[model samples]
Target: MMLVFALMLCVPAFACLAMAMERHQETLFGALLSAAASRVLRCAGWSALFVALWLAVAGKGWALGLVWYSGCTSLGAGIVYGLLIVFAKRMSAR
Candidate 1:
Protein backbone atom coordinates (compact mmCIF):
# COMPACT_ATOMS: atom_id res chain seq x y z
CA MET A 1 0.00 0.00 0.00
CA MET A 2 2.82 2.35 0.91
CA LEU A 3 4.59 1.37 -2.30
CA VAL A 4 1.49 2.19 -4.26
CA PHE A 5 1.25 5.55 -2.56
CA ALA A 6 4.91 6.26 -3.24
CA LEU A 7 4.56 5.46 -6.93
CA MET A 8 1.43 7.55 -7.21
CA LEU A 9 3.25 10.44 -5.58
CA CYS A 10 6.07 10.18 -8.08
CA VAL A 11 3.92 10.51 -11.20
CA PRO A 12 3.24 14.24 -11.02
CA ALA A 13 6.66 15.10 -9.68
CA PHE A 14 8.31 13.32 -12.59
CA ALA A 15 5.94 14.86 -15.11
CA CYS A 16 6.48 18.38 -13.82
CA LEU A 17 10.25 18.04 -13.60
CA ALA A 18 10.57 16.39 -17.00
CA MET A 19 8.42 19.01 -18.68
CA ALA A 20 10.25 21.84 -16.95
CA MET A 21 13.63 20.78 -18.35
CA GLU A 22 14.31 21.33 -22.05
CA ARG A 23 16.64 18.38 -22.34
CA HIS A 24 13.99 16.08 -20.91
CA GLN A 25 11.30 17.71 -23.01
CA GLU A 26 13.20 16.94 -26.20
CA THR A 27 14.52 13.56 -25.17
CA LEU A 28 11.42 12.06 -23.65
CA PHE A 29 8.39 13.80 -25.09
CA GLY A 30 9.88 15.28 -28.26
CA ALA A 31 8.33 18.14 -30.24
CA LEU A 32 4.83 17.06 -29.42
CA LEU A 33 5.08 19.00 -26.18
CA SER A 34 6.78 22.11 -27.51
CA ALA A 35 3.71 24.30 -27.15
CA ALA A 36 1.72 24.55 -23.90
CA ALA A 37 4.38 22.57 -22.05
CA SER A 38 4.47 24.95 -19.14
CA ARG A 39 0.70 25.03 -18.91
CA VAL A 40 0.50 21.28 -18.97
CA LEU A 41 3.23 20.92 -16.39
CA ARG A 42 1.56 23.43 -14.11
CA CYS A 43 -1.72 21.61 -14.29
CA ALA A 44 -0.03 18.28 -13.71
CA GLY A 45 1.84 19.58 -10.69
CA TRP A 46 -1.33 20.97 -9.14
CA SER A 47 -3.26 17.84 -9.86
CA ALA A 48 -0.56 15.74 -8.29
CA LEU A 49 -0.58 17.90 -5.18
CA PHE A 50 -4.31 17.55 -4.91
CA VAL A 51 -4.13 13.83 -5.32
CA ALA A 52 -1.47 13.60 -2.64
CA LEU A 53 -3.62 15.63 -0.29
CA TRP A 54 -6.61 13.43 -1.00
CA LEU A 55 -4.63 10.28 -0.44
CA ALA A 56 -3.18 11.57 2.79
CA VAL A 57 -6.57 12.57 4.11
CA ALA A 58 -8.08 9.25 3.19
CA GLY A 59 -5.17 7.24 4.54
CA LYS A 60 -4.59 9.19 7.69
CA GLY A 61 -6.22 12.21 9.34
CA TRP A 62 -6.26 15.94 8.60
CA ALA A 63 -3.17 16.99 10.53
CA LEU A 64 -1.10 13.92 9.78
CA GLY A 65 -2.34 13.90 6.21
CA LEU A 66 -1.06 17.40 5.52
CA VAL A 67 2.30 16.48 6.93
CA TRP A 68 2.42 13.29 4.91
CA TYR A 69 1.45 15.12 1.75
CA SER A 70 4.19 17.68 2.20
CA GLY A 71 6.87 15.13 2.96
CA CYS A 72 5.85 12.85 0.13
CA THR A 73 5.72 15.63 -2.44
CA SER A 74 9.10 16.96 -1.41
CA LEU A 75 10.72 13.54 -1.47
CA GLY A 76 9.11 12.66 -4.77
CA ALA A 77 10.17 15.93 -6.40
CA GLY A 78 13.74 15.50 -5.21
CA ILE A 79 13.88 11.97 -6.57
CA VAL A 80 12.50 13.05 -9.94
CA TYR A 81 14.95 15.94 -10.17
CA GLY A 82 17.86 13.64 -9.42
CA LEU A 83 16.72 11.12 -12.02
CA LEU A 84 16.28 13.86 -14.60
CA ILE A 85 19.79 15.11 -13.99
CA VAL A 86 21.19 11.61 -14.44
CA PHE A 87 19.18 11.04 -17.60
CA ALA A 88 20.20 14.40 -19.07
CA LYS A 89 23.83 13.64 -18.39
CA ARG A 90 23.62 10.25 -20.02
CA MET A 91 21.76 11.59 -23.03
CA SER A 92 24.27 14.40 -23.49
CA ALA A 93 27.16 11.96 -23.31
CA ARG A 94 25.80 9.86 -26.12
Candidate 2:
Protein backbone atom coordinates (compact mmCIF):
# COMPACT_ATOMS: atom_id res chain seq x y z
CA MET A 1 0.00 0.00 0.00
CA MET A 2 0.98 3.66 -0.33
CA LEU A 3 1.47 3.94 3.40
CA VAL A 4 4.13 1.26 3.35
CA PHE A 5 6.12 2.96 0.62
CA ALA A 6 5.77 6.43 2.09
CA LEU A 7 7.04 5.52 5.56
CA MET A 8 9.81 3.29 4.27
CA LEU A 9 11.21 6.12 2.23
CA CYS A 10 10.44 8.83 4.77
CA VAL A 11 12.62 7.24 7.43
CA PRO A 12 15.75 7.04 5.33
CA ALA A 13 15.03 10.35 3.65
CA PHE A 14 14.79 12.21 6.91
CA ALA A 15 18.00 10.69 8.15
CA CYS A 16 19.75 11.51 4.90
CA LEU A 17 18.46 15.06 5.05
CA ALA A 18 19.68 15.55 8.59
CA MET A 19 23.03 13.99 7.79
CA ALA A 20 23.42 16.23 4.77
CA MET A 21 22.68 19.33 6.81
CA GLU A 22 25.29 18.52 9.40
CA ARG A 23 27.72 20.96 7.85
CA HIS A 24 25.45 23.98 8.08
CA GLN A 25 25.97 24.32 11.79
CA GLU A 26 27.73 22.62 14.66
CA THR A 27 25.72 24.09 17.50
CA LEU A 28 23.67 22.08 19.96
CA PHE A 29 20.45 22.93 18.14
CA GLY A 30 21.68 21.46 14.88
CA ALA A 31 22.79 18.26 16.51
CA LEU A 32 19.56 17.94 18.42
CA LEU A 33 17.49 18.62 15.33
CA SER A 34 19.31 16.02 13.31
CA ALA A 35 18.97 13.46 16.06
CA ALA A 36 15.30 14.17 16.45
CA ALA A 37 14.70 13.99 12.74
CA SER A 38 16.47 10.69 12.50
CA ARG A 39 14.40 9.35 15.37
CA VAL A 40 11.18 10.51 13.76
CA LEU A 41 12.01 8.87 10.49
CA ARG A 42 12.96 5.63 12.13
CA CYS A 43 9.79 5.58 14.19
CA ALA A 44 7.66 6.43 11.19
CA GLY A 45 9.06 3.54 9.22
CA TRP A 46 8.63 1.16 12.11
CA SER A 47 5.04 2.22 12.60
CA ALA A 48 4.31 1.74 8.95
CA LEU A 49 5.78 -1.71 8.91
CA PHE A 50 4.16 -2.68 12.16
CA VAL A 51 0.72 -1.55 11.08
CA ALA A 52 1.11 -3.22 7.76
CA LEU A 53 1.85 -6.45 9.57
CA TRP A 54 -1.18 -6.01 11.73
CA LEU A 55 -3.29 -5.44 8.68
CA ALA A 56 -1.95 -8.55 7.07
CA VAL A 57 -2.96 -10.46 10.16
CA ALA A 58 -6.51 -9.12 10.03
CA GLY A 59 -7.16 -11.33 6.99
CA LYS A 60 -9.71 -8.87 5.69
CA GLY A 61 -8.87 -6.62 2.79
CA TRP A 62 -11.50 -4.15 3.91
CA ALA A 63 -10.13 -4.02 7.41
CA LEU A 64 -6.66 -3.48 6.02
CA GLY A 65 -7.81 -0.28 4.39
CA LEU A 66 -7.83 1.48 7.71
CA VAL A 67 -4.82 3.71 8.05
CA TRP A 68 -3.07 3.00 11.31
CA TYR A 69 0.16 4.74 12.02
CA SER A 70 1.76 5.04 15.40
CA GLY A 71 1.79 8.57 16.69
CA CYS A 72 4.87 7.60 18.66
CA THR A 73 6.00 5.19 21.40
CA SER A 74 7.37 2.55 19.10
CA LEU A 75 10.34 0.80 20.71
CA GLY A 76 11.34 -0.69 17.38
CA ALA A 77 11.37 2.74 15.80
CA GLY A 78 13.59 4.14 18.51
CA ILE A 79 16.06 1.31 18.05
CA VAL A 80 16.12 1.64 14.28
CA TYR A 81 16.56 5.39 14.44
CA GLY A 82 19.30 5.14 16.98
CA LEU A 83 21.20 2.79 14.70
CA LEU A 84 20.68 5.15 11.79
CA ILE A 85 22.07 8.06 13.76
CA VAL A 86 25.10 6.05 14.75
CA PHE A 87 25.71 5.00 11.18
CA ALA A 88 25.26 8.54 9.95
CA LYS A 89 27.68 9.84 12.51
CA ARG A 90 30.27 7.32 11.46
CA MET A 91 29.84 8.09 7.80
CA SER A 92 29.98 11.86 8.28
CA ALA A 93 33.31 11.59 10.00
CA ARG A 94 34.84 11.96 6.58
Candidate 3:
Protein backbone atom coordinates (compact mmCIF):
# COMPACT_ATOMS: atom_id res chain seq x y z
CA MET A 1 0.00 0.00 0.00
CA MET A 2 2.76 2.41 0.91
CA LEU A 3 4.56 1.62 -2.28
CA VAL A 4 1.45 2.22 -4.29
CA PHE A 5 0.65 5.47 -2.53
CA ALA A 6 4.20 6.65 -2.87
CA LEU A 7 4.20 5.95 -6.55
CA MET A 8 0.68 7.23 -7.12
CA LEU A 9 1.17 10.37 -5.10
CA CYS A 10 4.70 11.29 -4.11
CA VAL A 11 6.49 10.37 -7.30
CA PRO A 12 4.16 12.37 -9.49
CA ALA A 13 3.66 15.09 -6.92
CA PHE A 14 7.35 15.80 -6.87
CA ALA A 15 7.63 15.37 -10.57
CA CYS A 16 4.78 17.80 -10.95
CA LEU A 17 6.53 20.21 -8.68
CA ALA A 18 9.73 19.93 -10.63
CA MET A 19 7.76 20.38 -13.79
CA ALA A 20 6.00 23.31 -12.19
CA MET A 21 9.41 24.88 -11.74
CA GLU A 22 9.76 24.70 -15.47
CA ARG A 23 6.08 25.75 -15.77
CA HIS A 24 3.51 22.97 -16.00
CA GLN A 25 -0.20 22.72 -15.27
CA GLU A 26 -2.71 19.86 -15.00
CA THR A 27 -6.43 19.57 -14.23
CA LEU A 28 -7.73 18.15 -10.98
CA PHE A 29 -9.67 15.52 -12.88
CA GLY A 30 -6.49 14.46 -14.56
CA ALA A 31 -4.69 14.08 -11.28
CA LEU A 32 -7.55 12.07 -9.82
CA LEU A 33 -7.66 9.72 -12.76
CA SER A 34 -3.92 9.36 -12.74
CA ALA A 35 -3.85 8.52 -9.05
CA ALA A 36 -6.70 6.07 -9.37
CA ALA A 37 -5.25 4.21 -12.32
CA SER A 38 -1.82 4.10 -10.79
CA ARG A 39 -3.27 2.62 -7.66
CA VAL A 40 -5.00 -0.07 -9.64
CA LEU A 41 -1.93 -1.00 -11.60
CA ARG A 42 0.29 -0.94 -8.59
CA CYS A 43 -2.18 -3.24 -6.93
CA ALA A 44 -2.01 -5.68 -9.79
CA GLY A 45 1.75 -5.66 -9.96
CA TRP A 46 2.11 -6.15 -6.24
CA SER A 47 -0.56 -8.75 -6.32
CA ALA A 48 1.57 -10.58 -8.81
CA LEU A 49 4.63 -10.17 -6.66
CA PHE A 50 2.74 -11.33 -3.64
CA VAL A 51 1.61 -14.36 -5.49
CA ALA A 52 5.12 -15.06 -6.59
CA LEU A 53 6.45 -14.72 -3.09
CA TRP A 54 3.76 -16.98 -1.78
CA LEU A 55 4.62 -19.52 -4.36
CA ALA A 56 8.29 -19.27 -3.50
CA VAL A 57 7.63 -19.71 0.19
CA ALA A 58 5.56 -22.74 -0.72
CA GLY A 59 8.44 -23.88 -2.96
CA LYS A 60 6.41 -23.35 -6.08
CA GLY A 61 7.04 -19.73 -7.01
CA TRP A 62 10.22 -20.71 -8.75
CA ALA A 63 9.05 -22.35 -11.89
CA LEU A 64 10.26 -22.53 -15.41
CA GLY A 65 7.69 -20.04 -16.65
CA LEU A 66 6.68 -18.16 -13.51
CA VAL A 67 9.90 -16.15 -13.47
CA TRP A 68 9.01 -14.33 -16.60
CA TYR A 69 5.35 -14.55 -15.67
CA SER A 70 5.89 -11.93 -13.03
CA GLY A 71 6.71 -9.49 -15.75
CA CYS A 72 3.34 -10.25 -17.26
CA THR A 73 1.74 -8.20 -14.55
CA SER A 74 1.62 -4.58 -15.51
CA LEU A 75 1.44 -1.48 -13.46
CA GLY A 76 -1.18 0.42 -15.40
CA ALA A 77 0.15 3.26 -17.52
CA GLY A 78 -3.16 5.10 -17.16
CA ILE A 79 -1.80 6.84 -14.10
CA VAL A 80 0.93 8.69 -15.93
CA TYR A 81 -1.44 9.23 -18.81
CA GLY A 82 -4.05 10.88 -16.63
CA LEU A 83 -1.39 12.79 -14.81
CA LEU A 84 -0.20 13.99 -18.16
CA ILE A 85 -3.58 15.62 -18.77
CA VAL A 86 -3.40 17.58 -15.56
CA PHE A 87 0.20 18.39 -16.29
CA ALA A 88 -0.77 19.61 -19.71
CA LYS A 89 -3.09 22.15 -18.16
CA ARG A 90 -0.38 23.33 -15.84
CA MET A 91 2.08 23.76 -18.65
CA SER A 92 -0.48 25.58 -20.78
CA ALA A 93 -1.27 28.01 -17.98
CA ARG A 94 2.27 29.24 -18.29
Candidate 4:
Protein backbone atom coordinates (compact mmCIF):
# COMPACT_ATOMS: atom_id res chain seq x y z
CA MET A 1 0.00 0.00 0.00
CA MET A 2 2.74 2.41 0.90
CA LEU A 3 4.66 1.58 -2.26
CA VAL A 4 1.53 2.04 -4.29
CA PHE A 5 1.05 5.46 -2.79
CA ALA A 6 4.61 6.47 -3.42
CA LEU A 7 4.56 5.39 -7.02
CA MET A 8 1.26 7.10 -7.64
CA LEU A 9 2.63 10.29 -6.18
CA CYS A 10 5.44 10.38 -8.75
CA VAL A 11 3.07 11.50 -11.48
CA PRO A 12 1.94 14.94 -10.46
CA ALA A 13 5.09 15.51 -8.46
CA PHE A 14 7.27 15.43 -11.56
CA ALA A 15 4.77 17.33 -13.66
CA CYS A 16 4.48 20.15 -11.17
CA LEU A 17 8.19 20.20 -10.50
CA ALA A 18 8.91 20.58 -14.20
CA MET A 19 6.44 23.41 -14.43
CA ALA A 20 8.00 25.14 -11.42
CA MET A 21 11.33 25.48 -13.21
CA GLU A 22 12.56 29.09 -13.34
CA ARG A 23 12.50 29.09 -17.12
CA HIS A 24 8.74 28.60 -17.10
CA GLN A 25 7.77 31.71 -15.15
CA GLU A 26 6.74 33.69 -18.22
CA THR A 27 4.31 31.10 -19.51
CA LEU A 28 0.65 30.65 -18.68
CA PHE A 29 0.42 28.80 -15.37
CA GLY A 30 4.08 28.03 -15.99
CA ALA A 31 3.13 25.54 -18.65
CA LEU A 32 6.04 26.31 -20.91
CA LEU A 33 8.45 23.73 -19.58
CA SER A 34 11.56 22.80 -21.52
CA ALA A 35 11.11 20.13 -24.16
CA ALA A 36 13.27 17.53 -22.45
CA ALA A 37 11.75 18.18 -19.06
CA SER A 38 8.24 18.12 -20.47
CA ARG A 39 8.79 14.80 -22.19
CA VAL A 40 10.34 13.26 -19.10
CA LEU A 41 7.55 14.42 -16.85
CA ARG A 42 4.87 13.25 -19.25
CA CYS A 43 6.44 9.81 -19.42
CA ALA A 44 6.82 9.60 -15.65
CA GLY A 45 3.25 10.71 -15.00
CA TRP A 46 1.79 8.18 -17.40
CA SER A 47 4.01 5.43 -16.06
CA ALA A 48 2.98 6.13 -12.49
CA LEU A 49 -0.69 6.18 -13.40
CA PHE A 50 -0.24 2.87 -15.23
CA VAL A 51 1.45 1.36 -12.22
CA ALA A 52 -1.46 2.43 -10.04
CA LEU A 53 -3.79 0.71 -12.45
CA TRP A 54 -1.69 -2.41 -12.21
CA LEU A 55 -1.89 -2.26 -8.43
CA ALA A 56 -5.64 -2.20 -8.69
CA VAL A 57 -5.49 -5.25 -10.91
CA ALA A 58 -3.20 -6.95 -8.42
CA GLY A 59 -5.91 -7.02 -5.73
CA LYS A 60 -5.52 -3.66 -4.07
CA GLY A 61 -9.11 -2.77 -4.95
CA TRP A 62 -10.16 0.19 -7.06
CA ALA A 63 -11.31 2.33 -4.16
CA LEU A 64 -8.10 2.06 -2.16
CA GLY A 65 -5.99 2.63 -5.24
CA LEU A 66 -7.96 5.71 -6.20
CA VAL A 67 -7.72 7.14 -2.69
CA TRP A 68 -4.02 6.52 -2.48
CA TYR A 69 -3.47 8.08 -5.89
CA SER A 70 -5.42 11.17 -4.90
CA GLY A 71 -3.77 11.60 -1.51
CA CYS A 72 -0.26 10.97 -2.74
CA THR A 73 -0.59 13.13 -5.83
CA SER A 74 -1.80 16.03 -3.70
CA LEU A 75 0.97 15.55 -1.18
CA GLY A 76 3.53 15.18 -3.93
CA ALA A 77 2.52 18.49 -5.46
CA GLY A 78 3.30 20.29 -2.22
CA ILE A 79 6.59 18.44 -1.84
CA VAL A 80 7.63 19.34 -5.37
CA TYR A 81 6.83 22.98 -4.73
CA GLY A 82 8.98 23.00 -1.61
CA LEU A 83 11.83 21.27 -3.37
CA LEU A 84 11.68 23.74 -6.26
CA ILE A 85 11.94 26.64 -3.83
CA VAL A 86 14.98 25.16 -2.10
CA PHE A 87 16.72 24.37 -5.35
CA ALA A 88 15.92 27.75 -6.83
CA LYS A 89 17.47 29.49 -3.82
CA ARG A 90 20.58 27.37 -4.05
CA MET A 91 20.93 28.07 -7.74
CA SER A 92 20.56 31.82 -7.20
CA ALA A 93 23.25 31.75 -4.53
CA ARG A 94 25.73 30.20 -6.88
lDDT of 4 by residue, 12-87 (tens): 6465445645464433242465668666766776676566556644544577767765666666666766776787
lDDT computed for candidate 4: 0.60
Candidate order by decreasing lDDT: 1, 4, 2, 3
Error of 2 at 7 (Å): 12
lDDT of 3 at 2: 30
- Report the poorest 10 consecutive residues by lDDT, candidate 4: 22-31
- Candidate with top TM-score is 1
Give candidate 3's error at residue 17 in angstroms.
Answer: 21
Residue range 1-94, candidate 3, lDDT tens digits:
3333323443343333333322232243333335555555456555545554444334433573344333322222345455667767676697
TM per candidate comes to: 0.70, 0.32, 0.29, 0.56
Task: Output the worst ten-in-a-row residue range by lDDT, candidate 2.
Answer: 67-76
**Better lDDT candidate (1, 3):** 1
Candidate 2 residue-wise lDDT at 42 = 53
TM-score of 1: 0.70
